[model samples]
Target: AYEYTLKAEKVCEEGTQKQIPLYDHYFFSILICAEVFKLDSSFHDQAKKIAYKNLKNLKKVQTQMPKNFRSRYLLAKAVIKMNFSPNLKKEISFDFLSVIGVANEDNYLHIEGIACEIYGRFLKDKGIHLDGAHYLKRALGLYERWGANFKVQAIANEISNIQNDDFNKEININSFIEISESLSNERDLEVIFKNILETAITFSNSLKGAIFRRDHNQYFVISNVNNDISHYPQSIIDYAYNSNQIVRIDSIFDLEDFSKDKYFTNNQVRSLLALPLVANGEVESVLYLENSKVDKVFTADKTRILEIISTQMALSIKNAYLFKNLEKLVSERTEELEKKTHQLQISSGEKQTLIRVLCHDLANLLMSSRISFKRLNKKLKELELSDPDITRYLKKIDSSFTNQSHVIDNVRHLELAKEKGFQITLTTVDFLKTLTNSIDTFEQQISTKKINIVINENLNDIEVLSDELCLGVNILNNLISNAIKFTFEGGKISFGLQDDDQEYYYIYIKDSGIGMKDQMVRNMFQDNIHTSTRGTNSEPGSGFGLSIIKSYVNKMNGDISVTSKHKDDFPEESGTTFILKLKKAV
Candidate 1:
């Protein structure tokens, strides 16, 4: 048919009557060839190329033709273009509509029928079965009207094929969805391979199946069901793997030359199928299925379904391999962490014991020294030899002892707070009493600095949820002592209590003193920073006082914050205010 069309086109080009009617025979022949060849996969490509080349040539002289000829020419052009680029729906639709418009105006039934048939096929290819069937029926009616019995019968067959295809597609889609869901969460490679082989066997209605995985050039059995690795046809498997295509044999006799081979000649082995699972453009594995009972079990439809399953199986196998590796890495890391944690526990226990011994021994020695110093002061007073310098030296000695005691106590308390399983016992406590006791503890330092302590009148017998030892000794004592140490001579330290009708009450401790810098305030409560500065009288301190305060406050479920301005930053109003928000006793 293609050769005849070419011969007719050549004659039309050569003769003096190279006009519409002469070219009609060539185009009509070419159109029929395109339509017939498009139904067969073997000739589909050649048909498109031939039709496209001739239509492109016809396009140059198409405008000179009459309406009927131009419309027929357009219908043939659209059909060929659709074969070349089936996905170009918009361009194809516009071309079909243009042909139909001219056909309607000129009453060209044949041209319209052909346009509707091509449009219906395009829609059917895209899975629009209902709409495609509508157009197919329309074309069938138009062909009947134009007295083309063959085209009418062809359109009727197309509609029947669409109905069958739609049903098969629906079943295929549901099966794929179920298979995908079943394999989505499978992480074990052995389990994944087993499931894939079993599913392939069931779906293909095969008696036995095996999945062979490829590593470089080697193929090994990963999973098998009712079959051994040696039982599968190696030649079929090799062909599918090497060619990256599905190989199916309905019967041993179909192998032709290999039909007499031992594997194929066996009476028990009738049908064989080998499918290559390709991932990332590489053949990763091959699935082999055999049906001993049925000769032609692996049909074309079954082969297509198995091919789609092969794609999903490839991804599942890859993911399972990755998950296995990730699980191994996590196990190794967890074991290493456990070893390091054990070593750290031993080291920490040894350190804690050493600290406790030192604190205990040093506290007893300091107590003995204090007793001896008091006895000596008494003896000197009894002798009535009160030299002015002697009194001053004794005072300085006492101050040194006091500073050493404070350092030792701060270290001991900090160690206790950090001890494992240590917990603060919160209970209802008198807030006013705690404040007063803390103030009394720092009375000697306040007197030496001559700082006036102004207790707020609103500080009544208010109760708060707190640990008494943490609140009084660790928190309040450190804050009051700091106020006295930093205040200038005769400076004022004020305490204010506030109730804002909330779940917690606020306590404000403000002092008029040489306040802190921005950097000092920022790092004051951080355990890693050294924020301690010498007092107005050069009194010393352990830098962890605020750190201990913060830790205990957090344990008691309270909050603490500080606001300070250095004397350099604010000359007149330079002081630090520490605010504590403690829960009110219910």
Candidate 2:
């Protein structure tokens, strides 16, 4: 069938112009060929080549293929890889298990069944008869559900052959299955230790047993069952641990002065078996079982089974301890991160409060100085003597004082806005009247600079839903003051407003000024970057105006953006335009 499909695909690609169907046939043919080759040892080399080729093609077209098809292809490739490399069996097994998980999640029952069957066969060939039988039974159940009678029979036959080959091996397989299931299910170290102790007692046919675990080179009993014995003879446990060998005593009377040992004498132990659990050449734990009524109850076969169980138990317990410690470390680190985050918030609030206080104090001092200067100017005029140099110096001092006061006032407003989280009390604000007030505030500067202020006629009656007193006025005042400062003498500053679909009011402020560079414009509204630059007339600036304007605009649920070009780059096009979009008043 696979050869026929490949030939049909080739015919379609060459003659029929049906590319999609041809690709589908090609994918299925490769998949079927790989599976067919996997069943016979003589075809293993062919299977490996086809499987890898399929994997390469799947990678090229997986996104175009169905998810179930992709998962099945991966499973087939993993099976071939396992058969090809003996040294990579463990790695291939993990890959096979992962594919099984994804197949189960996707409810691809056919892929799940095939994966289980292949894994069972692999384990059986490796002499892991117990695990092999477990997987085979699972595959048998899946096949029965799907009504695949042939597959069910094949899997059941394999299981039967494994069981009938060795009777003692069957018992050990059952014990191992039970132990593996218990270890997989239980995570708590105490619970795991108790489960292992119970299984050990049952397998060794002992009346009572206890497991002592090593912690920091100290031995302590971690689990016990059906025994009132609190402590074991330290001498025997030490001998087994230090010698890295099993210590068994069939008859206590065989040793000289054995009655002097309190543990054996008091408990009347007839026979005892102690096995050391070693990992990486280090003794990690010891399993001690005692039979009070029977002599020589623990046989060599039972000891061997116990040895396997003890080795697996040691590794499981170590994993549980490591997991517990990892959880503790994660919790501690999370707590530390939360503490630092809270401290940062408090520090930010404190810094804002300090800025408000400092600005307020500076504003008060400036007001007093302005008043004293007014009186000093009046007295000088009364004296009827005016020196041009003295007059110019006094005017310069007054200008410096005025600029400093304006900067302080703006800073105080900004701090208040931040402290209240930019909260605005909404009110109907006449946009035209707000712009008029801002222009009036900067009238003296505009006149001094000989700047032409242009207002669009359409803005005469515009109104917006905003806080007119704090948010609206502050936003307009900052933008206009910036324009007046940056504009050269006799330059023009224009203001305009337009409504868009009755939803928002757009305001524009453009100025023919010594414009900013692209990098400067990008960082102007960010407080982290210091963007203060002198005006064309060498007038000082605080660099806080644009930041304050952005915050106020956001508070009113508005957006603001700027466009500019450096005068050195394009002298004729060198100017700035600030665009503000605000919600319309209803």
Question: How do the residues 1-586 of candidate 2 rate in per-residue lDDT, one tens digit apiece?
Answer: 6556556756876985644564455455555665666566776565456556656655555556657366666675676567566568788789888878888888877778888887887877787665666677667778888889998878766654554444234444334434433443344666777777766664454556777776676766764543332457666777787888897777766445335667665577767888998754677788888766556656666577567656556654544454455445544643553455455532556446656655655565556545545654564466453566556646655765665675666566676667667555888888888777668767668988999999889887777888876543568777888888899999999988644656887788999998999999998888644577789988656565688778878888888999998899989978999998988898
Clashing pairs in 1: none
Query: 143-164 in candidate 1: lDDT tens per residue?
Result: 9999999887777666645544
Supply candidate 1's per-residue lDDT for 181.
33
Model 1 residue 510 CA deviation in Å: 0.5
Stretches of candidate 1 exceeding 4 Å from the true structure: 1-361, 369-416, 499-501
Which window of 10 residues has the lowest lDDT sum in candidate 2? 165-174
Candidate 1 versus truth, CA RMSD in Å, comes to 31.6
Clashing pairs in 2: none
Decoy 1 TM-score against native = 0.34
**Cα RMSDs, all models:** 31.6, 28.6
The per-model lDDT (C-alpha) reads: 0.71, 0.68
Error of 1 at 468 (Å): 2.1
